[model samples]
Structures are given as C-alpha cells and as structure tokens.
Target: MSHYHYSADQLSQKQAYKFLTGAIAPRPIAWISTHNLETRVTNLAPFSFFTILSSRIPLVMLSVNRRPDGTPKDTARNLLAAQETKNETARTAGVIHIVTPELLSAMNQTAASLSFTDSELELLPDELQLLQEKDAPLAVENAKIRFNVRPFQHQLLTDRSDLPMTDIFYLEVTDFYFDETVFDAKREYILTEKLAPVARLAGNDYSHLGLLETLRRPD
Candidate 1:
C-alpha cells in the first residue's frame, strides 16, 4: 500500500474537494424532511452532506448548495423557514427522518431536482406517511429514527461571497423518535444491526453500516 500527501498550500480547491470527498468515501446519509410554507408541500431528500453538529447543545448541521443563478435549494429554503418557526415562538414542527435501505427508492425520487412548483410527494406519496402532529412527512414504515430539529441559527459561509455559494444550517434537535425494535436494553442505544442505515458512497453508490465492533481506547 502507498500513501500520497499534499500540503495545504499545494492543494488547489478542485484537488482538495476531490481528495476530501474521495478519502471520506461512504459517509452516512442524512434523510432530511422539510415543508414549503408557500405550497404547503413536504419534501424529503437524502443528503450525504449531513451530520450531527453537537451533542451538548443537541445540534445538527446540513450543508447546502446554491443554484448557478444564486437561488437556494429546496432543502436550504425549507431550513430557512424552519429557522423562522424557531425565532417566532421558540418551537419547530418539522422533523428529519433518516433513510435506510427500506426507503432507498423513495429517497432517490426525493433527490430529484424538480420545479419549485412541482410536488416531490407526488412521486412517492404512498411510500411516505406523514406524522400529522409534526406536520412533516416521513418514510415511517422504512425509517428507523426520526430527529426533530429546532433551529438555533442559519449561518452562511463567511467565504461564500462567491456566486453559487454554500451555506450551513445549525439546528438544535428537540425530539428523537425511533423504532422499538432497533433499540437494545443491554446496550442502552439503538442497535446498528437492526437499524441497517444506508450511507452514501462515490458516484451513485451507497453502502451499509454492518456488524459493528467496539474497541476501548488506550489511556
């Protein structure tokens, strides 16, 4: 086996992006759900650009990209709306339900870039069941865990002065819903074996988190 290294200054932006994305291949998918205030449409999409931002503050982050014309994507726009809900009365309704193999097809459909007026739910309405209280659509039968995000801040990248920019959303998780079968009393946490979460790989590929084994760190 061989290893290659590039100094920070030596790496071009394009090279850096490719190296990082490829090196970090097979990242977990964050299947986010959001609602459009104008159309009242609920959208769900799988984002490899998602992760838990914090545990102390119960925060989550979703990275989003702007269109070539500088318009925000649906997920970004909906997140902005969710943030507004937070500032108004300090509570948010929409939640993000994670996608597993069971919901792969529906997840793909949601990822389709549709017209702003077009309803994504129209593609897989039967597959997705909305949990009414949250007013957010989820692949209830397929999802193993659902996390409700109460937004604290919607921050733009300071370096995003360039056109077709990138943005980061910092959200505080308010609720956690999970399938009983996925939890283990012995472990005091959900079993990855039962959950079978899907993760994104390079170029139209995905992998699963299989048979985990824990190791204690050397102190």
Candidate 2:
C-alpha cells in the first residue's frame, strides 16, 4: 500500500482544514439555530466539529470557524449575547436539531451568510419555518430531536502568530425533546435507526447510517 504523510507545519490553515476534514471519516452535524427573541431573527446553520462533552451533566461542544475577515460567526455571537443578558424571555438561546440525509440540501442553504439584522430562517424549508414557541426546545411539535443549550464557556483558539481561527462553545444542554418515534418512554433510550441522522464528510459530501454493527465490550 502507498502512503502520503506530511507535517502539519508544511500546510496553510486552509490546506490543513481540507486534509483534516478529508481524513476524518464521518462527523455528525449539529443543525444549530440561534435566535434573537425580541426581533425573532434566527441564525440557522450546520456545523460538523461538534461532539458531546459530558453525558452526566449533559454538555456539548461545537467549534465555529471564523470568517476570512477574522470575525466570529453569528451563532457564536448570539450565544455569547445570551449568556450576558439578564432577561430570560428575551435572551437569545441556541436550539440544536438533528440532521437527516433528506434535510442536507436545506441545511446547506442555511449556511449562507446573512447580515446581522437579516435572518436565515427565511431560507429554511417550509416544514421547518414554524415559529419558535416560548419555553419550547423542539421549535415545532413534530421535530424528531432537539437540544436546548446554553453556552457557559467559550475558548478562542489561535495559531502560532496568535491569529484567531475558531471559537469553541462549551454548551450546557438545558433540555431535550425526543419524538415518540425515536424515543422509548419506558426504556429512556433513543432509537438511532429511526432517527436516521446524517453526517458530514470532506468537501460537499454527507453520509447516512449503513450496516449496523454491535461489538460488546468485555466485562
């Protein structure tokens, strides 16, 4: 077999990102929705660098890459603003949804950058354009799974020269909504196969579940 290996220092930031994402098999997508409650402006987007930080405390983490202009993404800013505000009703909160293969196209469209005053909700598909109700995490009644998160910690990563690259949000999951089809009330378990989550790959590719496997660990 042939091999291709290069030092991290040899690549530019863009090159490094490309190579890293290309090799990182399948990463789950966090279809994040940040809302300005007063104006009802939503910043909906998808991020792949997301993972569970803690299961006991119900925490999650997602890294938002900065723009070419060195500005933090809207999702990052909205969550930060939410943390600072005293008003609970008006505070902007992050509502994270699960992505299925069928929703990939609509998810991509939400990735388009809009002005601070503009909203990405305008571009969402008809089914997902419902209004977000107060004290609701699912956004809509039929949503499969959604996590209502509050950002408690943020880490700004920088390069060698101190140039900022991404903002890492350590979010505390406040609540979760699981539809009946994907959840077991008595067992308190999520049905993964029914959820049908989609994952992000390199470039413009995405993948769904295939070939279930089960390998029990040794006791």
Candidate 3:
C-alpha cells in the first residue's frame, strides 16, 4: 500500500525521462532507413518509441526525439521532410525494419550519432553488415522483417526552447517483407522465436523473445 508518486509537472527533465522510459519496459523497436535523394546517401536509425497506429489500413508510428543539444536527428531530417509533398503517393518513402537477434550487431551500429551528410550504414564492420546493391537503398538487407512506408501524416510534438523537440510520423505501410524462414505463408503468422526480434529497454538495455503463452478469452 506504499509506493512513490511524483507529479508530471514537478519532475525534472532527467527524472521525467527516466520514469517514462523505465516504466515502459521492453518496447518494440523500429529500425528505420531513409534515402536522401539529394545527397544520394542513405540514413538508418533506430527508435524505441514505435507502435502500430492501425492494422486494418496498415499504419505504424515512429517518433524521433531530438538529441541532447536539441537538434533533430538525421532520420527525422531526411524523412521526406525537407521536400514535403501534398500527395501521399508523391511523398518520400522509407523502410521500417524489425530487428532480430542475428541483426542486433548491425542494428546497434546504426544507432550511433552522425552528421546529416554522413551515412551510418557505412560505419558498420564488414562482418556485421551485408547489404546488396539492388536492395541497398530500400531497407536493411540483414533484417528479417520490414515495412515499406510512406508518410500518411506527420505532427511536431512541441518546439519549446527548453525542451527537446520530437517529430511524430505515422507511416502507411505499403507492403511487408518477411524472410521465408520466419514466415508461415499458409497460416500467415510469424515464428516469433525464430525471428527473435529485439526489444528496447531503458537506457542501453535490449531484450529478445522469451517464453510465450497464449490465453483465450471466453466467448
């Protein structure tokens, strides 16, 4: 019957972040990749604040938070953002990938902070990366699951000078790419253990698939 409670308005930035991120343990991560047509360079980054907005229409959300210095990260900057278009079809597109255990090393490598002009994919060691020429710009070649996404709607969280700005993008999933090994075509369900998708914990922690049990609701 005893627990600590703090008011949101009273908490400091560090305290607020620590509580939010810590309480929301093991969140699914979105390993996003976008191409800057102008620079002819690719950008890849990971966001833990990701989830499905709608499944019937196929939409997913990825939130990109500004850095400690209050600057937008490369992915947010490159997200068909600079050249926004009115038409959804004409809008710039990118890929949202699901990280598996095998791709963990490469995924972590892409999370490094780099300049807008610099490409993060190139920073990975040869042993952890294997990108194909034709499929190179689309998505991470090593990831088992991916969503070809186009920006359906975008909103800026807030721009207060004292607080970090975050960009909220709801992407329409045009299609899904699943490696045959992890997909069950007949049943149309993924093999969770085989994929062993990675989840983000607070700070530098990550988690993989564990024991699973299905519970059914009474009809």
The numbered model that scores best in lDDT is 2
Models 1 onward score TM values of 0.84, 0.90, 0.88
Better of 2 and 3 by TM-score: 2
Q: How many steric overlaps does candidate 2 have?
A: 0
Candidate 1 residue runs with Cα over 4 Å from true position: 1-18, 85-90, 125-128, 134-141, 158-161, 185-187
**By descending lDDT, how would the candidates be arranged?**
2, 3, 1
lDDT of 3 by residue, 98-208 (tens): 988877877898888777788987876676544433422555667788787778878777655646578888888877889999999999999988888899888888988
Stretches > 4 Å off in candidate 3: 68-70, 80-83, 87-92, 128-136, 159-164
Candidate 2: Cα lDDT at 218: 100
lDDT of 3 at 137: 51
TM-score leader = 2
Model 1 TM-score, 2 decimals: 0.84
Displacement of residue 144 (Cα, Å) in model 2 is 0.8
Question: For every candidate structure, what is the RMSD over all alpha carbons to the true structure, in angstroms?
Answer: 3.0, 2.4, 2.6
lDDT to native, each model = 0.73, 0.79, 0.78
